[model samples]
Structure formats: C-alpha cells, structure tokens
Target: MGAFETLEPEDPRQVGRYRIVARLGSGGMGQVYLARSPGRRLLAVKVVRPELARDDEFRRRFAREVAAAKRVNGAFTAVVVDADPDGSPAWLATVYVPGVPLNEAVAAHGPWAARSVLALGAGLAEALEAIHAAGVVHRDLKPSNVLLAADGPRVIDFGISAAADASVLTRTGSVIGTPGFMSPEQLVGQPIGPASDVFALGSVLAYVATGVGPFGRGAPHALHYRAVHEQPDLAPLPPEVRDIVAACLAKQPHRRPALAALLDWLTTMDGSNEAPTLRLSEPGWMPDSIARLVREHTSAPLLHTPPPALPGTPPETPRPVPGTPASVRPSAASQPPAEPPGPTVAPEPKAHPAPAPAGEQHEPVPRPSVGETHSAEQRTDPATPSPGHPSGRRPRLSRRLVLLGLSGTALTAATVLIAWETRDSGTPSTDPAPEPGGKSSPDGAPGTRRWSFATGSGVDSSPSVAEGIVYVGSNDGKLYAVDAGTGRQRWAFPTDDHVGSSPTVANGVVYVGSQDTKVYAVDAITGRQRWAFPTTASVYSSPVVADGIVYVGSGVKLYAIEADTGKQRWASSLDGLAASTPMVVGGIVYAGTSFQLCAVDADTGKQRWAFPTSGGASSSAAVAGGVVYVAGWEGKLYAVEADTGKQRWTFSTSGRVYSSPTVADGVVYVGGMDHKLYAVGADTGKPRWTLSAGSEVSSSPTVADGVVYVGSTGGKLYAVKADTGELRWAFSAGAALISSPVVAHGVVYVGSRDKKLYAVYA
Candidate 1:
C-alpha cells in the first residue's frame, strides 16, 4: 500500500543501475521494485517478465514507450528517470512516490469528503492536462494508479500508455486497462484521446465520493458494458458534484468536458463567491484519518542509511515542521542532508501486507458457461433491465401502423407472432414497438424483427445499418442494401470478386473491400460507384474513413486514399499480407498482418511501429485505452501497447483464432476453432468463462442489451449473457455461420453459408 514491501529471496537484488531495496507490487506485466539509484534517489523499477524480455519486438517497443514516458513531466505525475529495455531482465525506473495508493487509503480510511474529493479532482485534471500536453494518454487512470501523497495525488503506471504521435503497441482488437474505471469508448474499442482520461477521472472521483465505482462492481464485462451503454449511478453523489461528474461520464468522448474545463468546474464546487481553490498543502485538505496513515507510512524507516547532515545545519530532530500538520509530521532521520523538506518515513509499516483494495486485484469469479438465470434479486435496479430483456424500462405499446411498411409476408408473420405472444401471456404489453424507421429502441436496445435476405452466394460480411437500411456484402461479389424493416433489397452493386470486408457507411457513401484487389466507395442511397481505389493484391481489410481519408490494407501495404476522389494519398509497406481490417483513430491507423501488427500515420501512411507476433494475425484490431486486442491464427490473443507496440499480456485458446475480438465492459469476446467462445479479461488476459460450441467458431461476437450474439460454423447463432456467459437461446441457420452478428432494432442479423441473411429477435 505504501509502495514498498520486504524484498523476498526470489526477488532480484538489483536491476539495471538500481539496487532493489523492497518490492512495491506485481502487475500483469511484471514486478515493481522499490529501488535506489546510484545517486541514492528513490525509484520504482519495473522489471519485465522473462518471456517478454526474450521477445525482441517487445524489447524494442518497451524501449520506445519508456523514452516517450520519460518526456512526461507534471506536478501530479511520477517522473520517469531511466530505463534499460535491453537489460537482461529489462527494466524502467520512475520517481518513487512515498505515499499510499488511493485505493489503499480509501479502504483504510473510508471515502474522502466532498471538499477533499474536489481538490483531488482538480489536481488529477491538471495532471491529465500536462499529460495530454506532452502528447501522451495515460490509458490506465484508476484509483489504484493514483498515489495519495501529503502534497496531493500522483498518477502512476504508464504501463499501458502511449504517445499521441507514436505508433500503437497493442495487438489488433485487444482491450487494456481496468474495467471499473474505463471510458465508454475504451470498452467499445473506439479511438481514445485525452477525453478518455477525463472519463476515467470522472470514474475515479465518483469512487472517491461514493466508495464504489460509478458503474458498480461485478463481472468486469458487465461493468464495461454498462459504461458503454448505461447511465452511471450518480444517486449517491452530492448534488453540487453530480452534474459535473455526469457530464464527464457522457457516452460520447466529445461530450465529456475538457480537462481544462473540468478543472475550472472543480474550483467552484463549494458554491463560495470566491473561486474554489485546490490547496493540497493547506491543513485539513485531506481527511484526518488519511493524514495519519500517510504520516505513519512515510515516517517508516528507510531500507538504507541516509547521507550525513550539512556542516552548519542544526541536528535534525523528529519534530513537526512549520506548515506541516501535526498528524502528518516528517521523520527527521529519513530525510536526506541536502534535499528539500518533504514527507519523510519512520520505518517500514511492519511488513504487513495490506488488504487488497476493492475492485483492484481479485481472482475473477469464474462464471458458468451454460444455461443460468438471474432472478429478480440479481437485478435490483428496475432501470437496469435483466439479461434478455430488450429494454430496461417497462414495455409500452406503440402504434400498430408502424408495421405496415413490411415489404414481405415473412415480416408480417413475425409481427403477428409478436402480437400473439404478448396476447397469450395474459399480461398487458408495456413495451413499445420501434418507431417506423428507427434502428434502435427507446432504451437503445435493438427492436425485435424477423426478415431474410437471400443472396446468390454465402454472405460472410456483417450487416451495417444506416438510415433504415442494412448494407452487407456476399461471396457472390455484390454489396446489397436491404430495407431495415423488411427484407426487400434496395440496390445491389457488383464487384469483381467476393466481398469479404464489412461495409463502413459514412457521409452517404458505403466503403468496402473485395478479394478482387479493389476498394470501392459507393453511394449509399443509389448503390452507384462513387470511386474505386485499386491495390496490388486482394483487399480483405475493411476500410475506415476519418477526416476525408480512407485507410485500408491490401496484401503487403497499407494505403491512405482520398475518400471523395479515390486518389491515393500514401501507402506504407507491411511485413506480410494484410489479413484484417484497419482501425483509424487519433491520427493513427492500426492494421493486422500475417506476421505483425502495425501502426501508421493516418494522413501520410508513414510507418509508426510494428509488433511482431508468433504467427499471422487475421483478427482485426480493436483499440481502447492505449491497448490493442488482436488474435493470432496460432490460438493466442494478445494485448499490446498502442503507442509503442509493447506486448502487455496474452491469452491462449485451444484452437486457432480467426474471429476478431469484440470488447464490452471488461471482457474480450471471440470465437476459436477449438469450437468454443471465450470471455477474456481486457486488462489481464485472464479467462472469465468459455462456452463450448458444436463445431469451429469463426464468427466475431457482438454484445448488446447484456447479451452476446455470435455464430458458429456448426450453423448455430447463440445468445449468451455477457456477464455470466450463460446461454439464453440458440437459433439454427441450417449451414455454417461465418459472418459476424449485428444487433439493431432488437434484432440479431447474421449471414449463413447457406446463402441467406437472417434477422431474428435478440
């Protein structure tokens, strides 16, 4: 809790140029040691795992990220001092903060009062402002990463951070960071920026104010899912702070207030006519209990003797210093002869292992993979619907005329069935049908609908919904746009080869890739080709558009094309074939190849960094909180750093992984050829649950409304609870299902090898 523990025999005596004095703590990556520099300055040296040290790519990335981290300097942040990524064990050193972690402090002394929490928020916001100014994003900003010093809070752990301009280090499609405090975009694998940190700050401040995470504590996946789609529980927060915290927790990153803006808000929390100030140095800023604990921990004896006192200085005494509170006095003997007045230690806190902070470190509760049900008690909030419930609020009736637009008898029959089911239950229907052309329900859940669109060949591309239309591609070389409320095709545009890449609709244009070595931009409404960009080889990587640029990978190169003109902007070479789709965020483009995961500048297509993998990666990358989630064909799922391409952790599946991972809450969901669907931890890569399927599973999972919907090669579409992996229901497609599932309007849409696209109730 104090960042120092007795060094065990197994711990190394030294790492790089530092002598290890004690252990700080262990994370998923490696052990952090409290060590002293050659000059006797305290440092926290994080030694890399042996396996990671042996990885040449990891070592290279580690060095780069360390260099980037060293550039970060701020009052509320621990400064990186040195590192030796090429060392035998590899290590990085940061200024050792002599304070208790926020989690530990909160656990021992209870939640901080409103005034202290406001000060904490202001300091943290300033820290984020500095971090972002350095072009860095502290992806993991949680209570545990914060140190509560006498002066203020210090944010630590750049283990999963990245520079804004640096290449991402994470594997494609992996999620990183603790779940309870992650931002909505991080949970959904969206591009993260400084705004993401603001969201995390909101979560942390909420925890400090309410003693629990804003999203609550439970299965990480559930928490992450809630972060993405549900409103945080601010009911316990004080009225003065609730609105600001709520604004910070907005689902859209752009909606969240900037750090500077947030700092301004925090300064006026007391409703005082004078501007509220963050005075950490002032007495009573921190609660008395926490101050005593800080004093006790810092006053603990040093592992080694301090340098002699200056010649003319009066003999140092264990007395309270002016401006320092009586409850938090410095230890005279622990101070260095020439150093400035600061918190001093007495002796190590009896080597007592502190209790793990709530929601900090605990073995994940393994959930059953098969059928399990949640009772009323399991769902205590009526506002939070139970799993399988389409809407959280009670159902309501909508105008029946909304169904009149059905284009086929099949949809009419399905609507009739829905009416019959509601009537037969003998319970008044409280759920309303979707608005005539809306894609989502009142509660943001997909509405129930039944429709089928048959193509000339199997449809492997997942459906993308826009403007009441569903766009999908098929092996028959055609992109089809079908009515959302019915199964009628609005238009079909033919390509030269199979359309395997999912369509991305933006600005009235549909962008997709084909096996024919071409990327096409077609008008969404007319299905007319707007423009086409040709590559040297097949383009299986889906195109992502940002700022009028289209990023896609084909064969051995990643290309940036003008979205409107289809003219090539730039192209960067890759180590192997581009096997997955490209993700563009924060001016960076991430793509997976047969042999590596690469990041490039979105505008110039200049290579930023690439992390080599043991095998080819066909799984598309998901970027969240400075981590990339990607799977190798060799059965391993990896979480890599986004800025420097450093490997954070990996989870091995029994079979090959071709299905891309979808992250929700704190869980990464993906299917494997081992005929199983797995729920893996986004931060630690630990397994939460696994559900066995009848055959190989190559379909990526989609999570919504607390349910995970995925298809298997065994021709079945499964609906499982996102929190527990419990099977809710299954639908047979009569053929192998290779397409990923999409949920909209309470309907699950997936393609089957039988040449049909089916839409059924979620």
Candidate 2:
C-alpha cells in the first residue's frame, strides 16, 4: 500500500495548529491524516470517529491507552506526541515514521534471510521490553503493527493495550485480541500479560521466516482452535531460528522465554565466539529486496496538498455591519476600500466607562498596538495620572506655541515618535526614563523592598497583570485584584473552595479555577462573578483563555469553555489528574497529567498527541519555535517536538521538578527540588549554567529585560542574568516561596509562605 493517499474534500484543512497535507489511512478507530506543524515538521494526526468519542467507557480506555503508549519510548517504536480523548471527535498525533509495514514488505519480497529475521526479532523484543517496562501489555502484536525502517523495525499501534497499574477498561471474559496472533490464554478470555505478547511475537517471526503462519491458513475459529490445541508447523522454518520460535510458542505463559532472553539468543544465532549484539548497525540487516522496497516507500513526498473544500462549505467571510449598503459590502475576493488620501492621524484615547452589573455583557474597548501613538489633542482626565506622571497633576505648556509647532512639523514629529517607539518596544525596558531611579523600578539598589500585599492565607497562585491591576488567587478561597502601583487591594471575589489556580485576565475578564470543581469568570475591574462552569472534580489547573475559549483542568478532564458565556465547548479526559496549568500556542493546548504531557486541539478539543515522562508531570509547558520544554517530577527536563512529541534531548537534575519552565532568548530556565536553578539551551537541552539556592526551588522562573527571577523554598528570591545564570541580587522573604514570579514595569512580584506578596527590585 502507498504510504499516503490523496485527501478527500471532507478531510479537515487543519486540526489544532497542524495543517493537514494528506490522508495516511483509516481504521475502525479513526482516520489518520498526514499533517505538518507551524515549523513544517511532519506528524501523523489521527482523528477518531465521532461514535467512539461519544462512548464514555471507550473514551476512558482510549485515554489510558494513549498515556501508556506515550510512556513507551523505544528506538523501535513510533512515539505519540499529543492526544485528546474527550473531544467531540477525539484524536491523536504521532511521529511520522517513514517505513513500510512488515506484512506488505514480506508479501512483496517473500521470506527474509536468517540474519534479517534475527535482527527483526531483536528490535521488536527491545520494543516489547520498553512497553512492558511502562506497565503496558500490547495484547495485539500482529505483523501490521511492525514497520521495516532503514535502521530497524518500528512497532506502532497500541490501541488495544492496557497499563497494568491502571483500572481495566475491558470487561472480564471478553476476547479482545486478534484471533490469528492471540495467545492460547487470550483466545479463552483469560488474564493476559507480557507473556501473551511473546506468543504473538513467535507467530510473527514464524510467518516472516517461512512466509506462512505457524498455525497455518484457516478460518479465525479454526485458527483459534489450532493455536490452543495443536502444535505449530515449524518444519518449514530454518533450523537456525526454529528453536527460538518454538520456545516463544510455548503453550503456557511462564514457559515462554522473556524478551531479554530471546534477544540474547538472537544476538548469538551466528555462533561466533564473541557475542554480537543485535544492534542492526551492520549493513545488510534487511534482505536486499525488502530494503529496496523500504527505500522506495520512504522516498515518496512526506506531504501533499489536500483537495479543495467541498460544495456548500463556503470559505470564511467577514460579517457585514448594520446599515452598510449591500453594494459597498466587502466580498471575500475583494480588497477593503483604501483609506482617504492623507497622513494617518493618531486616534484619541476614550474616557473610562462605568462598570457593568454582575452577569451583564459589555463590549470590549480596542487598545492600541505597541508603537502606536495617541493624538496630541486627545483629552486627558485631570484627576488621573498619566503613564509617566505620578502626582496626578498636569504640566502646563503654551497651547498656542505647541499648536503652532505641531502644525509646522507634524509629519516629521510623528515619524520620529513612531520610530522611537518601535525601537524601544522590541526590547523589554530595564527602567523607563521617567522612573529611572524611582521606588517603582525593580532596578533599585539591593536590599530594598518596593511594597508588599498581605492576604488571609499563603499565596501560591502567580500574579497576572492587566491595565495597572494585579489579579491572583489565594488559598483563602478568594480571587483578589490589587493595585499594581500601590499594592492595595481593590476588590476580592470569594469562592466556596480554595483557589490554587493562577488567574488569567483577558478582555476585561479574569478566569480562574478553584478546588470546588468550578471555573469562574469574573469582571477584572469589579471582581464580580460573570459566570461559572462546574466540573465533576476539584480544579487545580490554572485557566488559559485564547480565541474566546477558556481551558482548565479538573481532575482527569481538561475542559474548553466559552470565555464569555461559560458554556462548555468540549472536555477531554486524561489518564490521570491534571494539576499542571496548560500552555496554548498556535491553536494547540499543552497540558500534563500524572504521567504524560498532552497536546490538544484548542478549537475542537481533540487530542493531537501525548509525551510520556519518567514520573508525573505537574509543571506547565513552555512552547517556542515549535518545541515544548517541560519538566517531569522525576528530576528531568525534556525538550520535545511540538509536532511529534519525540524527545529531542533530556537534562537530568539531582532533585524532582515541580516548577514550570520558562523559555526566553533561546534558553530554558527551570527550578528543581535539588535547591538549584538551571539554564539550558532551548533547542539542545544542554546545560548552560546552574545556581545553587538555599532550599528547594519549586517556584517557576520568569524572564524580563534579560534577567531571570525565581523564588526558592527557602523564602529567597533571586535575580540572575538570563544567559549566564549569574546571580544579580537576592532578597530574603523569611519563608518558603512556592508561587511563581511575575515581572511588570521593571518590578518583580512573587508570593511567599510568609502570607505576604512581595514586590522586589530586579
């Protein structure tokens, strides 16, 4: 079969951020699409059938299977990058391995030579070892799941697999595996384990070695009967491999040799005095005909343009404004009308409006982009201070002279203002000119505290800033909005349960999740609850709002809800509890559970893929340039492909990692329980430097103006150079600090277990 087929019109143009290029194939579970990331990395995206997604039991099973598959990171296995199990049409994405299935290869070229068969056995055994190590049992290990790559064989498709430690999704006495390759125990609906996989392995090897099944051709029932009661016809197999295959085909599970033992046997099949490891490093590991077939299959184009959209599904169009003439309406093919011929005039800032009542909707005001200027004639509130002025006073100037000057040099002054703003906006400012040495500037001399805000309980939630207001959640069951300049609370919204999730502010709304199993959207200015969506369990994962959707995790489910109305768009069940905050970028939401980091379609709630780690992951992900940087609780930081979930590299630490990672200027900064902070290369995962802290470093790091700011469990906050990890300054808060730091207007804001929020100088 061809590696890829042309996509039909009904195929999605894009799933999450990945663009669909072609159709890989369709199966009972889903249709697989050849897709590409924003960085042009190829991925195999599988969109599950709608019926399967709606089945609650099936969704749970799929989630568990995806998690287990991600944990299997073997050289000879396809890696899962992302997945969403609770979406309307659940999906998953895996690394696009370019190889032909073993069945196809063997069918086209006949049986493989003894050496090739031995090598294949070793590679597949190693893959099985990895899978079993992750507490997973691949119940169905047929030839179709084995791909003959140039380097070795890759095992794919863990759909029917189950994690040993997880709850069983299948019913007792249910026959779940394929009939032809299933072990005798599996055929009788008995408890299956890793040994079951060994039996299937033998069947596959027998077929590859002699071009016939060990049980011989028959109906599925007949084959089942033979597998259970009759011995395999191994007479056609070569003597060199016959004994090993016979051992694997042992009727009893315990009688079958372990994968390790089998691999050792395969390595010495040549009978050399020196034991040769079956690394498949030697040329000619594959038969010449099979190798040629693999080359031809892999050499085909990885991606192809999908067919055009089908009829009746017109392309997107901008909505027409009320009272606009039909003749003047802009069409999809037409350009907007040109602006009037004149120099672009800056618009005036509008007056602040009164706050709306609770649950009332309000139109959001448009804000100017960076470098955009306000008109000189714009009205200013006399009682309010301007951005640079702190005294709430206006400077007097000669109106006539200013007007004359503006009229004379309007164009030149506007050009200069735009250029200056553009240049400075590109780089984060260490200190603005107006507050060069003011107390508000974090660059003040060491040992100075700018301000502190105290609450009812310790603050673990990170602060988010918007329009001079700082919004954060507290363990006291309250969401507080404080004045960023004065450190005084403006308002606090109370919840029934403790609030550990950090608040996210967007479009005048503050979204947060609480332990009461609810996600709340409140007015950013008034702290009045607008709406709340309830989940089945407690919510600890922080909420992220993007494209009018609010995403948060409650227990094992991640939900996407309408930001304005609080109506659920979709909910994806994970394999374990999701306590890690999600990071959304390029239409994908990256979140973690106890064992895996999952990438989900932000729009559809479908999973794109998942990446397994050595331990549970509570750390939020950082995405940049199509790569994801995340820390696992196992004391390792991983650089994973944003498109394929394949591990690029890993950096091990001496302690566990609960702190989220921050990526800035090509470096990733993270903290660990080992009482140290690390700076690693974003692309290579190579350590640049490390800084020892007084205690465990669980607080996530933040970067601003080329400086890294992070807090430690020792209650010390340190500011270091982003590129070198050299300490610039450290402040003692007299208690442990678990809350992450946030930088705004040159000041660093973090909370400590001392029950106080500290604004420290950078």
Model 1 TM-score is: 0.46
Per-residue lDDT of model 2, residues 1-762, tens digit only: 543455565667778778777666554355777777777777778887664566677788788888887888887777778777776568788777777777667767789878778888888888888889888887767776787778888877764467766535654111234435779877544678899999989988998998767876421223454587678999999898899999999999999999878878887884432222335655578899878877777675444443445788632222222211110000101000000000001111122222234664343322223453222221111221111100000010000000000000000000000000000112222322222222353546643577778888766556665677767666677878777667777788888755656665556666776656678878876677788788765455566555666666655567877767777888875544455566556677776555467888877878898776654453556666778776765677888898888889999998656566666667777776667888898778888999987566666676666777777656677888877778787777645566666666666777655667777755
What's the lDDT for residue 205 in model 1? 87
Model 2 is weakest, by summed lDDT over 10 consecutive residues, at 412-421
Query: Which segments of candidate 2 are over 4 A away from where they belong?
Result: 1-357, 360-447
Q: Can you tell me which runs of candidate 1 are displaced by over 4 Å?
A: 1-3, 172-175, 270-278, 305-762
lDDT of each: 0.59, 0.60
- How far residue 458's Cα lies from its native spot in candidate 2, in Å, is 0.8
C-alpha lDDT (0 to 100) for residue 396 of candidate 1: 6
Q: What is every candidate's alpha-carbon RMSD to the true fold?
A: 23.9, 24.1
- TM-scores for every candidate against the unseen true structure: 0.46, 0.46
Model 1 Cα lDDT, one tens digit per residue, 1-762: 432355555677767767776665554346777677778887877777675577776677677777778878888888888888888888878887777777767866777788888888888888888778877888778776787788887887763476666545554212335556778666444578888888889988888888778876422222443576568999999876788889989989899998877888887784332222337655676889988887887786655622334777432222222221111111110010000000000000011111111222111222222342211111011222111100000000000000000000000000000000000112222333323332333343332336667899766565665566777777688888877666677788888766656665556666777756688777766677777778765444555555666666654567777667777888876655543556554677666655567777776777888776554454666555677777775678888897898999999998656666666676777777677889998899999999987666666676666787777666677889888989887776646666666666566777766688777677
